[model samples]
Target: MALKPHRSPRRVNLISPADRIRPDAASVLLKMVEEPPPDLSFIMIAEDLDAILPTLRSRCVLLHARKPDPEAAASWLEAKGLKDFDEQLAEAGGNPLAVIRGHKIVPDEARALFLGLLKTGKRLDITKVAPGVGTGWKLDACADFFSRWGTDLIRVKSGLQPSYFVGETPELQSIAPGADLQRLFHWLDETESLKRASSVPLNNKLALEKILESYRSVFRS
Candidate 1:
């Protein structure tokens, strides 16, 4: 058996995004937050409150940042000399900073690829689509894509409009009938866990394979 290395605890200021901190780290951080050294302080930021660990969230004073209005965001983008400002604003979900920083919140290609795979139904093959679910940030983006796709499917099944893929309602409708609701919702839960765990180093290939396999199971007809 290998011996476990000892770690020396040190005092330092922590400036981290609440969402990015993993569960294990959060537990350790919680103790610090509950009682920190006089010289140390913590500043945590997070866009999604639900993504933050509940224990950590409860300890901090919450500050809500309202998203900008779409029209205002578009105007800001235009003032910055960005063409197709409306499209960019929509793609960024009206987050002006995201548009300004050139972050593509909506992965169009990944969404299309996932929808196509969903359309395959029982014939879906995890190996063939594994490349699309690339490693690291790309894999995280794929999980985001699948989460939205699954939400849209659920919405369509409930006789509601597909929020993420409005134009692809017909395709959503096609797959909704065959989708295993329980499995799909379970997969959504798993993807949320995956997204929360994304900040840490992970086995990307194995993770993607498992996700794709779950996707395959969701469409068992």
Candidate 2:
């Protein structure tokens, strides 16, 4: 008789950002999910469902959560005593929970350092950025910032106001002239790829260095 591993009466395996799961990890998870114990349940959440593995996605019942009302969400955050979240709230496209998650996950200092580097353009020192947002989930945060900032650069170049970082219009205007629009667009794609990959275990400093290298390259003549 095989030895049985002890488990509770009910078990749930939760995977958020399901699309970021490594292929090998997904294969192992697939096995358990395929023939999971009756008491086991898997709940997966993803920002982009199509990016998740089809086999795994097919096994679960899908449900979509509606976006919360922005005004209500802002009120809730205010009631919780959170101020200075208006930027994150707008950045999240009015998704209140995302604003809260971002606030808790990243430090304010790291955010300031990143934006300062963005304004530095070709002079951006990678050493300064490495410590600010190079570890663990901070890497993901930095990647998200760069990806969105790249979009704002596009808006500025096109004579439209930025959606995020409306407060940084002067800085964006200063940097936009130096950046090639085509390269900025390409950098956006690269930043997104890096953000998705940041979830995996890797050298945090090296990853930030690589991403910031591409950021400098966008301004190449």
Candidate 3:
């Protein structure tokens, strides 16, 4: 019956069933649903609506959010031309909002460095790579790229999809058939976790070297 904002300041009044329900508390929540407030509208959001009471469902005016226009989504995919589009979408939990936020958060310099590394045949010195890959914003940028690259490689190995940032490197493709993509994924996970727990350590050079070395080893094998 009462309304309030989701966040602080309470500028908007929104109500949800999840906020008021409790175990062992005898309350007629159904009544509130049955007779909503006058001069106000009620909106119910659920991933699965089968659990709601039949009477409540019957009385409710169901309004479903329309799916994104296929042509618009296709235009977006065409713009990126990413081989791992599905993977990125998956990482963003299939939510278009999350995908946009994720892309927006990517650092421009970090992206440039990634392209540079790939072009150098994985031969770029750690000294040169450090400035581009160092821990900034709590090592977030580096960790995100690392994870995304690893995921792309894993997808390639599984024969499910191509990689977004990956290219047809003769050297890489020659050895990729014999490479251990799973091992690389595990190492990426370990490095990401370490970077997160280290409180932005001073040895970013060492971290960059380890990451590149591990990646080079994948193609070398």
Each model's backbone clash number:
0, 0, 0
- Give per-residue CA lDDT, model 1, range 1-221, as digits (tens): 12232553434454555676667878998898898765455678776678777988898887777887767777777888888655455445567787778777436665555667766765777776657653334655666766877788898988997756566678889778888889889989888877766666777767766776787788767
**Candidate 2: where are CA atoms >4 Å away?**
1-12, 79-84, 91-93, 98-105, 130-137, 199-201
Candidate 2 lDDT at 176 equals 85
Candidate 2 vs. true structure, TM-score: 0.75
**Ranking under TM-score, best-scoring first?**
2, 1, 3
Which of the numbered candidates is closest to the native, going by highest lDDT? 2
lDDT of each: 0.71, 0.78, 0.53
Error of 1 at 61 (Å): 0.8
Please write out the lDDT profile of model 2 over residues 1-221, one tens digit for every residue: 12343676676767887877877888888888898877767888887686677898888898998776868988999988889888788677567877767643356666677778888888788888666663345666677777778888899989998877777889899888889888888888888788778767768777878888889888865
Two-way lDDT contest, 1 vs 3, winner: 1
Question: Per-residue error at 46 for model 2, in Å?
Answer: 1.9
Cα error, residue 171 of model 3, in Å, equals 9.7
